[model samples]
Target: MRYLCLIIAISLSSSAVFATEDMDAKLDNYRSAVGKLMKVLKPELVNAMKSKGPVAAIEVCNTKSPTMTNAVSQETGFVIQRTSLKPRNVSNTPDEWETKVLNQFEDRKAKGESPKKLEFYEIIENDGKRQIRYMKAIPTSKPCTICHGEMIPPPVQAKLKELYPADKAIGFKVGDLRGAFSIIDTITQ
Candidate 1:
């Protein structure tokens, strides 16, 4: 049984690495799709801010769906609206998410480069081997800080609370990495 367990572990680790690679490829595709949308959306959002005001721009963000999957906001641990590919699910606790991705952003931030985005790779450990399974993250910008920043406006705070009752996503600055792309691959076990 011990030997069987070891074999299973080794197999899982190997599969996890392959999964991570596959997820990375998918994340790249997702970025390309969203990058195209941002080109048009950014300008429009900026225009709305100038004419209708920041609220209008925020409203647009609230409604926009850059991807079909929901994206995580690293700042508050809140998931953003329709963005990302399927299989990108939220964790029950902030710690769970942090262990998986947010801490990496913090590490990058400590290095002086803001984590503008993140890619989550699922790592599986079996025996003595480790491998990545999948990855994903969200794009961040100045506006993202309004809600995720160190000081969230009351309206934004209220909205966030409503959307995420157990939210911890907040206290971020402009140009900071708001979230990362996550990758999850299937284990070949």
Candidate 2:
């Protein structure tokens, strides 16, 4: 009986350690995927803004963002996308799970948490299949204001209207929560 009790205790402790390690691994994978997506997209946006202007940069986002996201997804073998409560693109609107997560992020930000450091992940199991979901908050920056700020230039506004007629990703200032990068993946155990 003593040996059985010892063995059970050890097993429970070891499983806790393994669960923690597993969570760490999942975080690493999710963070790397977000980094890669940013790396692929940020430079082009910067260059577009620098070379032409906010209007041209808007075009780049309209035409190139999906391609860039898809390429990153292919490279990383992960399903990744961006979402927001107020999305410039309708397709980028948050779904049910994402909506709940976005609201949580907003509440966290309101409580003085740094948006840049805000991230959430979940391990969901359904019918014996495991899925992982993660989201990292995206904070609005100065450059983003050129297109998404309260004072967008007329040309930028016209272009934005032309491309994203139903856009809601505006009226943001630096340090505001713009949205998040969301990733979903299934992992084999």
Candidate 3:
């Protein structure tokens, strides 16, 4: 009986330790991936605004990067079918996470607070397994304002409309939530 108790206690304690370590590693991966993407995106956005204009820069972001989309898939089970300045219809795949994050961002703006590190969890099923995923929103910077700001320049606005007819991704300021770091089952390995 003493040996059985000792063995059980050790097993439970070890499992708990492993769980903690797993969570830590997952978060580290999430941060590393997001950090790498931002490092690349920030400079490009700044340069685009300085040389090309806000619209041009945003265009680059729209087509060029899949940091958010890829992250959603890798972290969560869901695939981001589309992320537009405005909402659009897709034959399949709902934009549930993106829409929720965006709405939270707008609410934060209305409350005169910068949305940062906003998080939420979603339960999902993948390959017959149940999983929980997390989503986080981080604000855009000063440079981001030019494209997603309250008052875009006329030319920039025109370009935005042309590019994103149903665009709803505007009316933001520096330090306001531009988007989020969505995490899914892609928790730590």
Task: Report the C-alpha lDDT of model 3 over 25-142, residue by residue, as the tens digit.
Answer: 6556555555666677678778877897676787667765555556545653543333333432122122565577667666766877546555555555566555455555666677
Question: lDDT of each structure?
Answer: 0.51, 0.86, 0.61
- Alpha carbon lDDT of residue 105, candidate 1? 55
**Clash counts for the predictions, in order:** 40, 0, 10
- Ranked by lDDT, the better of candidates 2 and 3 is 2
- Candidate 2, residues 13-131, lDDT tens digits: the string is 85454377777987897898788777767788889999988787877788798888888788878789999999999999998889999999999999999999999987766556666
Quick one: how many clashes does candidate 1 have?
A: 40
Better of 1 and 2 by lDDT: 2
RMSD of each: 8.6, 3.2, 5.5
Candidate 1, which ten residues in sequence have the lowest lDDT sum? Answer: 80-89
lDDT of 1 by residue, 79-145 (tens): 3322221111234233343354566655666787634444444456544544333333454577666
lDDT of model 2 at residue 17?
42
Residues forming the 10-long window of minimal summed lDDT in candidate 3:
85-94
- Comparing 2 with 3 on TM-score, the higher-scoring candidate is 2
